[model samples]
Target: MKGTMVALGGGGFSMSEDGASALDDYILAMTKRPRPRICFIPTASGDADTYSERFEAAFRDRADTSVLSLFCHEPWGYSDPAMLLEQDVIYVGGGSTANLLAIWRLHGLPEMLEKALDSGTVLAGISAGMNCWFESSSTDSYGPLAPLDDGLGLIPGSACPHYLSEPRRRESYQHWVATGALADGFAVDDYAAVVWRDGAFVEAVAEQRDRPVFWVERTADGVVEREIPVRLLGQ
Candidate 1:
């Protein structure tokens, strides 16, 4: 079965405060299941309680929400990675991309996520969550924006989230792609998400108007970039 993944640059149920719930609403609709089982993975922030609590509050009444914490200490080797594969949707939160990758690798979550995807789970996330899906991405893991070459590679190219929020993000991603430091990839503005189905680009979605996703690649002449139109949701 073909599965879907929505990689959000920023702005979602947990981040937006202007009564803007469009992106999260879209995620819910994507599940195509009543009371869909949605799991939140917050390992990026060291499985911090506050982040998980924010997630729970945002999704509490919207779906059947649960959190899978990988770093809990209290005989808390309690979570089964297998549970991740059972959900209808998996949402990852933003944080240190490098640390997240390292921890996920330690727990074999990358493999489990792939299995979950194959089972038609709708995977989604913002920032670090978005970066994890690509072959590589521009990240702030090293204190300044830099290219991260190893990713889950579920998507075939690189990606940059928070393209608009972070001033250096666009330039860094473009330079990396142009210098052969990173493969050709996509980038998205805040509040925007690039959607993929069966690992193919479908379209971009945004909670706000005019937020676009870009395709960037190295060209003989220089780096080439173009905006991919985004469909505004929750209008």
Candidate 2:
């Protein structure tokens, strides 16, 4: 079953109320099928118990959503599309960016992921999942898994999450521009999300403005910051 990919600005496993669209949209899209196979991928890290727990909590028991935990650490998360072809949604959990990318490549998951998504298999990622889809990643992901020199390019720009959740995140985001690392990026706060539709940044949804998301572009000199408005409630 082919579907769309929804890359969220925040991790939905824990704080799930806001990003329900990622799941709901997938569910609603399957019109002619009994239900699409829904799998939650946690392989970016090795914590199966916690990953499964969070996945179950976010969705509880649903006839349509089956709880499947995938760990990229096993060196086969990316290589096994046969295990994923029946899945309607591949929801990636957050973890170390470098480790996530490494495992995906080691298991040959990036190419598989791209094929799955291209065929209409819905791909939804949070945090590390979101980071892996873009053309590049932030240095922030370096702390946990080492910065990824390569990434799966479902998205054409860089992805930076936990925007206002951290102290001096503006400084951190700006540093990318100052140092000429990645030019265009989407900086999403913990409560926000940036949706890509037909290969473009289409929607930005948030819960507050204090922690808003950003869309950046690179120029010859430095990166230019553009504060994209999010349709957050009461903002």
Candidate 3:
């Protein structure tokens, strides 16, 4: 069973004005099931209630939506890491990438996620969620935008979310890769998502036409940024 992943730079239910989006639908469609079971992990946002509520309201009608809160005062939804394997899609919410990783590690989630992936669960996330899947990423988790080398390493190279929406993300990421501080990788604009199947990049998709994805690489001349062609969703 090949693993699948959808890393969104930004703009999903969490960012959408209506708490619903074509990109969210695109993620559900990846399961190829009549009604996929999707679990939202909001650890990055410290399991924010509003975030989870938005997720439920957005996906409840279309998919079997559930929230797995690791920080709840009492047991909330599915607490066992093994339960994740039953999900058709595991969607992670955005917040502090650094905190998310630290908490997930303490709960032994990284290993379970790998097992779930190997068993064909589609792992998807936005912003911090997107950043956690790569070897390194440009993040604002610690304050100002900076490079973070510790990630789940599910995908090779590095990644930067909000490439276009966030100020300095593009220039800073490019500088890091160019200076050998980070590996060559991808950067995604708000509303854009990059797909990977079996740990290899498949394509890019976006909820809006103006949003794009890019491949940032280091060269002797410095850094090269190339805009990747994106398929506009809901067309």
Question: Please, what are the lDDT tens digits per residue for candidate 1 over residues 124-208?
Answer: 9999999999889899988999999889989988999998788888888888999999999888999899999986889898988
Q: Which stretches of candidate 1 lie over 4 Å from their true place?
A: 18-20, 73-77
What TM-score do all the candidates reach, one by one?
Answer: 0.95, 0.78, 0.97
Candidates ranked by TM-score: 3, 1, 2
Error of 3 at 168 (Å): 0.9
Residue 193 displacement (Å), model 1: 0.3
TM-score of 1: 0.95
Error of 3 at 102 (Å): 0.7
State in Å the error of residue 180, model 1: 0.7
Please tell me which model should have the higher TM-score, number 1 or number 2: 1
lDDT of 3 at 152: 92
User: Compared with the true structure, what per-residue lDDT tens digits does model 2 show for residues 1-235?
Assistant: 2335566666454566533433344333542345556677776665466666656555544425544334433322333445666666777877777777776676667777777776776677777777888877663555632234467777776777777676666566667755767646788887577767557666776644555778767777777778888775443
